[model samples]
Target: MAWELATSCTNQRVVGSSQIQNEAMQIGRKEIKLNTTSRAYVDPDRINELKTISSESFDLSKLIRLCEELNICFAGECYLSMVMLTRAILDHVPPIFGSSSFQQVANNYSGAKSFKEAMQNLENSSRKISDYYLHSQIRKSESLPNVTQIDFSNNVDFLLSEVIRLLKK
Candidate 1:
């Protein structure tokens, strides 16, 4: 038997074997274009590198998603979202390093000296920046963060590289 589904002049044909036909009929096609004038703060190649790590014992879904969203927010110039997402990634990945907090990860993780330093920068600077944005209230005078104020890509890349190393082991 065959079935057909139709909506708004679009039709899908289903076969008896539960297969969907590749070709569908459309009465009219509407095209919508979006603005493409955006830039990425975190290099997309770094994000792609994180996507390559997979481990049976560890679930990196949330961590990877946070990195993806952080890049998107940065590209959109949403510095607040970028900062919050950066902090969230730090908070969420501690357990992967066998630590309860990013501070502990910075202070205790048995890695290279430079790696620990990067983590410390993230734990201190990024956390403090995000805290200010998360906890502050509206006032008569307010200052918005520019790219320079929220640029933490190098530290984040270092952290992600460490994560990949740990997971691959």
Candidate 2:
């Protein structure tokens, strides 16, 4: 794949190949390079599956939109946005599981043990993290969250899979 480098205010150049001698190329006083790879935290297929479900009882528009935004935030390295979106989803999906809250879903839903575990993790862990970020005041010494700190991808995928299963039934 050809990578484009923005050298200056007006001039741009394309590198012919992926192999470059240096990660960044110096053009005059500016260093220019391409960020080639992109990341997806949420599986696109899972979002597609949610879209394919045509249910009259449940309006999934908001849920699907949250999931889509979660994917975008993670890919763009917006860890706080991603965490908040995840918390929103956990708050939004309870009624679909015949419960009024995620905690109740985690405890009472007749899902597989693994599904229940995933729900509990999201309910306990992600919610706490989200709350910390959401409610904590600015302090003298504050540490920002990184990708590893906010990664709940597998748990979310498991939860989405269960949602797809339940909705299709």
The number of the candidate with the highest lDDT is: 2
TM-score of candidate 2 relative to the true fold: 0.76
- Superposed model 2: Cα runs more than 4 Å off: 1-38
Residue by residue across 1-169, what tens digits does model 1's lDDT show? 1112212112322111111111121212111121222244445565666667778878887776677666445434467888999999998999889999999999999988999998999999999999999999999999988767777877887888778878874
Worst 10 residues of 2 by lDDT: 1-10
TM-score of each: 0.74, 0.76
Per-residue lDDT for 11-59 in model 2, tens only? 3232211112222223222221212222455666777788889888898
Which candidate number would show the highest TM-score if scored against the true structure? 2
Query: Which pairs clash inside model 2?
Result: none
Global lDDT of each model? 0.67, 0.69
For model 1, state the Cα shift of residue 144 in Å: 0.8
For candidate 2, give the lDDT. Answer: 0.69
